[model samples]
Target: MAYVVFVGGLVVVLAGLTWFASWAKRRGRGSGVAGALAAYEEAYRTTAHQSHHELRQQADRKSESGSPDDL
Candidate 1:
């Protein structure tokens, strides 16, 4: 039936993606799809959220400038 064919195609696509992800992982951290994903995540996090280190550095800079308005 048409439904069965559609489901089969979906399954095949999912399986291929799973395989590719595993392959990328095995290729290591600094290369291939895994590296690209890591770079993207780091960029997004840096822009979207402030880490503790970043917050501390910002606070230090404000204190150095002795500007209460910065707070």
Candidate 2:
């Protein structure tokens, strides 16, 4: 039960981090975000490729069912 709450909190935090990164860039965070994004991209490099294909396959199943904030 506590683990589930922790995971949910983590998701929300990551979402906020994503939004903050985008906002920071707009306000000129520069290399600050570049490095972070590079690390982030590397972290998910393999999963991203697979997830890309999976998302494509699921595209027809639920047009409005998933979150588009997958960046």
Which number leads on lDDT?
2
Q: What lDDT does candidate 1 reach at residue 5?
A: 100
lDDT of each: 0.68, 0.74
- Give the residue spans of candidate 2 off by over 4 A: 31-71
TM-score per prediction, in order, is 0.45, 0.40
Per-residue lDDT tens digits for candidate 1, residues 1-71, read: 99999999999999998998788678754355444655675777665234534654686784446569878
- Please identify model 1 stretches exceeding 4 Å from their true place: 29-71
**lDDT of prediction 2:** 0.74
Extract clashing residue pairs from model 1: none
Candidate 1 similarity to native, TM-score: 0.45
- How would you encode candidate 2's per-residue C-alpha lDDT over 1-71 as one tens digit per residue? 99999999999999999999889879876666555655675577967656655664796575566568865
